[model samples]
Structure formats: structure tokens, C-alpha cells
Target: METARSQQQTAPGAFLAFARFALCGGGVGIASSFAITALAAWMPWSLANAAITVVSTLLATELHARFTFGAGGRATRSQHAQSAGSAAAAYAVTCLAMLLLHQLVATPGAVLEQIVYLSASALAGVARFAVLRLVVFARNHAQTQKPQNPQQPPRRHAVAGAAQGGLISRSESVEVTLAS
Candidate 1:
């Protein structure tokens, strides 16, 4: 029964995590696409795309680390590296898709190129989310099972004073009773 209840609770938590990932990923994608398109107007398409990918990936990594994966600001160096690696994998997929699309249509228009980029980015976002959840920020079972900050002092309780000699002050007595 406890296991079933825990699973039920975790299901909502998992969905919330996925929702955060998607929200952050979508924001990054839109910003990256705009930057890429603008750069492409002034520079070579491939160069602009690559530059934007790196910048956006870094932004997305930080966002995912803090918001999506609940890593707070304590992500380890290895985790950061893994996040970057996942970004690279996603970038590779987008680049490959772009290449394939270019091959299919010679001299594709700017609008068509943008369309392909957005499509590829959407697909890569899905892949990136999976990698981020499963590999980059994978939670260890032991860590989850263990209490955090075990070395820290336990919380003080007013009842502890009353237990000693009923010597607690009026405020402490009220606190203890309220706590009970």
C-alpha cells in the first residue's frame, strides 16, 4: 500500500518535471532560432547556426540544471559536462537534419530553412529532455533514500525542555502543545 501511494505521488512529480523541461526547452529554442535567423542574414548560415547552438545550449543547460532537474545551484562538474554532452548530441541531430533537408531541396528559401531548423530543434528537444533526466541528472537511489544534511543538528523542540523538568517558559509550553 505504501509502495502504491508513493508511486502515485511520484507520477505527478514526474509530470511536473517534464513540464518544466518542456517550458525551458521551448524558451531556449525560440531564442536560439531568432538569433540564428538574424545572424544568418549577416553571416553564413552554417556559422550562425553553430554559434547560436553553442550559446543556446549553454543557456538551456543552466536552466535545466536549476529548474527542470531540481539540482539547484549544486550541479557537479561532471553533471555540467554531461549536460553539455547531451546538448552536443542534440545539436548533431539538428545539424544532420538540416543537411538532409538541404540535400532534398536545392537552394531552399530562407523561410524553408527556418522551418527545417525549428522542426529539427523540436525533435532534438525531446531527445535532450530524455538525456537530461536519465543520464545528466539521474538521481541515485541511495541518495534519495538517505536523509539530506545528516551531519546537521536536529531541530530543537520545546517538548525537550518540558521533558527535562517542566521548566519550559510559557511561550515554549504553548509551542510544544501546538506542535503536538
Candidate 2:
């Protein structure tokens, strides 16, 4: 059916959107990791990581709206808030992983710490993608896109017949139909 074909086409578009989102998210994570590493030299590791996470999350949120979700200038305030919430979730995951890693290896070297951070970020990326695609942008995209099939107004049909006094009697009925 036409509906099935249209849905098949939409599936590919959704996949492509997810692919773009992952790529952009990965790039942002890498950049943020580098910034965090640099900042760690001057500040406490946790403080540096937190500061970079906030800035990078804001930047990534905007980038995701513009490029990943193709929302561009049309992204709503609520959508942006959702994006920020997703980032916060990812950040929490990363931080927790870092805490666990530090617990296991009490005094990890700088390189080891960076490795742990990047690994945690990669895991968090998957969560971020799911939240962004399924929660933040899904409904908005569906609402903005036109429906595959639209319902047409009901049609009226009339029939006329001769009456006893040479007057015409008319009967009318409504027919409902769907547009392809």
C-alpha cells in the first residue's frame, strides 16, 4: 500500500538523521574531552570536567538542532530544554564512570584518566542519541512534516424524482472518501 511505501521512505530518512546526529555528537565529545584535559592542568579535575561539560553541552545542543535534527531556526524552547536534559544525562553517566574508574585505580596517570573519560563519553553518546531522537525531536518532527494521507471533506450526492403534483422531490446523502 502507499502508506507502507511512504513509511519505508521515512525509515531511511530517520536513519540518516541518526547517523548525522551521532557524527556531530562524537565530534563534540572529542572536542570537549580535549578542552577538559587542558583545563585539568590549571584546575581541579572535577571542576575542569564540569565546566567543560556545561559549555560543550550548550554548543552540542545548538549543533544538534541545526544539523542533526534539521530543526534549524525552528527548534522550540522546550526542545532545547530537552536537548539540555539529554546532555545532563550523558554528563552524569560520564562522571559516574570516571568516579568508578578512579575508585578502581586510585591514582591513574593523566593519559589513563583521559582514556577513561573518552570511553565513558562513547557510552554516553549512545544514550544521548536515543534521548535526542526518540524524546526531544521525534514528536516535533512528526508534527512539522505533512501527513502522507489527508482526509477529504465528505461529498454530497443528490437524486431528484417526479412527485404526484409535477413537483420534484430531492434526496441527498453524504459520501465520505479518503484521498490517496
Candidate 3:
């Protein structure tokens, strides 16, 4: 059977998913920036950034599962773990870019720093999208489907016709079963 999830994995579906991903992830990223700035006023800068990243990642993963990839419900623990892995990579990417900029330039202006960070983050975000689509949330999603009661077997109805010297029997209906 062609499931809605399978349909969403197609070309148009991928486009829609990418759009939703941009909206959700971008929104979270923007919010995280402001949140980190505000929180930094009260706590250590590093601690504030870490706190915002954790909260933003949780929000983004949930949005991706439900709205971006159309996963039909909340994210699973496995999905959260995978998303965190990708987010960590993205964090490392941005951090490394800044470190490189500082080492190469004696004094880089705030504008240059923002450009480098945003560029690195954009690259990482693209990679994260692919990982989320093809790795983290790639499943049949059949669990959402209801199953027929195995205890009550399907009743078969048939007809028997006369043959040359015996009986010819055939089922009027066909029963098909699929595994996995």
C-alpha cells in the first residue's frame, strides 16, 4: 500500500519538507540567537548559549517531526538522539569557523564575524536537513496504522463447479498478506 509517509518522501514532498525545515529550523535559530543574548546578561555567555541550544534543538526536532517531515506525531527518543548528534556537528562547524577567522585575522570586525558564522551555520544546516530526512526520520511509519485482529481470521467464501469427473473449486475472493 502507498502510505502518506511514502508519498511525502517523493519529489514534491521533499520540496515541501525542505521548506518546512527552513521555516522551523530558521525560526528556532533566530530565536536562539536572541535568547542567548538575553540569557547571557544573567549568566556566563557560554552557559547561556548552551542552554539556548538545548532548548532550541528540542523545539526544532519536534517541529521537524510533526510539521517538516510529516511524521504524524511527536518525535521519538531515537529521533531526539539523532537530531542532537547533528546539532552538535553544526555547533562544532560554527565554532571552528570562528576559531579559524580569529587565527587568520589579527582583528576581525563584528560584521566579518557574523558573516563567517552565518555562512558556516548555513552549510551545517543543509547537512543536518539531509541527515534528518534520510537518517533520523526515515521509517515506514506503519505503527500509526491500525491492524486487523489476528484472532478472528478472515472467513473465506467460495464456489464449487462440476468438472469432468471431479469437483473444481476456487475462491471468489483473494486474501493477501504483506510482511514489513
Best candidate, TM-score-wise? 2
Quote each prediction's TM-score. Answer: 0.69, 0.69, 0.67
In the range 1-180, model 1's lDDT, one tens digit per residue, is 112223323432557878998899898898888898899889977788789877887777778777777664556777777877877777787788789988999888877877888898888888878887877766532244333566643233445544467555546522111111
State each model's CA lDDT, in order.
Answer: 0.70, 0.70, 0.72
lDDT, candidate 3, 59-129, per-residue tens? 99999988888776799998999999998888888678877998999988766865776778779889999
Report the alpha-carbon TM-score of model 1 versus the true structure.
0.69
Q: Global CA lDDT of candidate 1, please?
A: 0.70
Q: Report the number of clashing residue pairs per model.
A: 0, 0, 0
Better of 1 and 2 by TM-score: 2
Pairing residues by index, what is the TM-score of model 2? 0.69
Clashes of 1: 0
In angstroms, give how far residue 78 of model 2 lies from its true place: 1.6
Among all windows of ten consecutive residues in candidate 3, which has the lowest summed lDDT?
171-180
Off by over 4 Å in 1: 1-12, 140-180
CA RMSD of all predictions: 8.8, 12.2, 9.7
